[model samples]
Target: MHHEAVGRDLSRKVHAAEAAVDHALIEIAALTAALPEARMRAGVSGVTGQSAFDDLAASLSDMTRARARLGGAHRTLAALARRMGLGAVAAGPMDKPDDQPPLDGSGGVTANMVNEM
Candidate 1:
């Protein structure tokens, strides 16, 4: 029982980390998409210099590195979930209740339900 509790805590941490990574990836992708257009517009308007472009490129590179780190975090979380027998939580979208178990009102939560939350 103690081990199960510990596993639950770890699984929560893993899922939280994975969600953070997923959010970071989304933000990074958005920034990456907008940066080029912003740079191009600035260049066309003569309002930005080569140095500004270089700075934007550097920022994009930093975001790229962040994205990679987030990916690593996601993979690590997935592995931990698998170890905890909660691998299916990370398998894909939870579009159906059949993919999950109904709550028993026992003050205990299942992985699928937690993921949905």
Candidate 2:
């Protein structure tokens, strides 16, 4: 009976952890979703060719650059984890680029690449 109670306690702990991770992921999604509009708004304001827009424009641009730096950090940490056999690469080479042509020498036009033109 004591063992069963301990098992139940562990199961509840796992469920709570999973729920917390899910909530964090949802919050991350929300923040990324707002980036595009902020970028566009800042760009349009900056294009007035006026000096007054400089600070806000720079900050908005920095947000994107900072996000890119964060991505690099994430990749570096993920790679380190993979080297230690902790996790797999999040984006493997087998994940195809949408607009790339095939390298098989089939002399075939890739539809996605052709569509871009």
Candidate 3:
């Protein structure tokens, strides 16, 4: 019963983390769109110059940082799910090729090899 409860809790946490990541992605997209619009408006109004550009750059950098944080949250949630034996459920499908042999040379796997496989 305790294990089941832990599993339920982990599942909830994973869902919450996924939702948070989705929200953050949406926010990042919206901000990415708005930043350009804002810059354009500022340029048209003659109010945005070097300083405005700098501000927009900073905002973009901040958004990138937030997205990284969201990614970390997702990793943490996945770890928690794994601890509860729900990692696969949270991770979704694994379509990785099982027959792809390890790279044998320093040149790295070529595109032709991938295509042939």
Candidate 4:
């Protein structure tokens, strides 16, 4: 098969993966918000459901690591596509344009950002 065909197939899979990841993150967010609400509804103090809240926080941490790993895989696939001479192909939806200025116009300089470098 041609490289273009392979790139298309990869692109489709990437999009699907991104969607699944996004959905899982959304669900996690919902649960994170709901736990506090549930605790409040139960007329309990914050300490009452501390254990469950801790577990949920741990799960979120695990999911974050998984997300970072997936992001790395996405970058690797992009590099492969370029090496295959497929040029720039759409892999998945981006939350925002990389070139776009940050709302504060600090260009991330003032932001507490994580860097792999």
The best candidate by lDDT is 4
Q: Which residue pairs of candidate 3 clash?
A: none
**CA shift of 4, model 4, Å:** 1.7
Against the hidden reference, what TM-scores do the models get? 0.43, 0.35, 0.42, 0.71
Task: Identify the superior model by TM-score, candidate 1 or candidate 2.
Answer: 1
Residue 35 of model 4: what lDDT?
87
Prediction-by-prediction clash tally: 0, 0, 0, 0
lDDT of 1 at 30: 74
Q: Top model by TM-score, which number?
A: 4
Candidate 3: segments with Cα more than 4 A from true spot: 1-48, 91-117
Per residue, candidate 2 scores C-alpha lDDT tens digits across 25-105 of 555555545555665877765345444345445655665565556546544643344344333222222333542432223
Q: What is the C-alpha local distance difference test score of each model?
A: 0.57, 0.45, 0.54, 0.67
The deviation in Å at residue 80 for candidate 2 is 30
Q: For residue 87, what is the lDDT in candidate 1?
A: 37
Model 1 lDDT per residue over 1-117, tens place: 564566566656655765675676576567656766887876665354556656656766776677678667755665565556653444333333433433324635445533556
Looking at model 1, report the run of 10 residues with the lowest lDDT sum.
Answer: 95-104
Give me the displacement of residue 46 in model 2, in angstroms: 11
For model 4, the superposed segments whose C-alpha errors exceed 4 Å read 94-96, 99-117
lDDT of 3 by residue, 23-97 (tens): 765765676567557768666653545565566567667766776786677556545544554433432222235
Q: How far is candidate 4 from the true structure (C-alpha RMSD, Å)?
A: 9.9
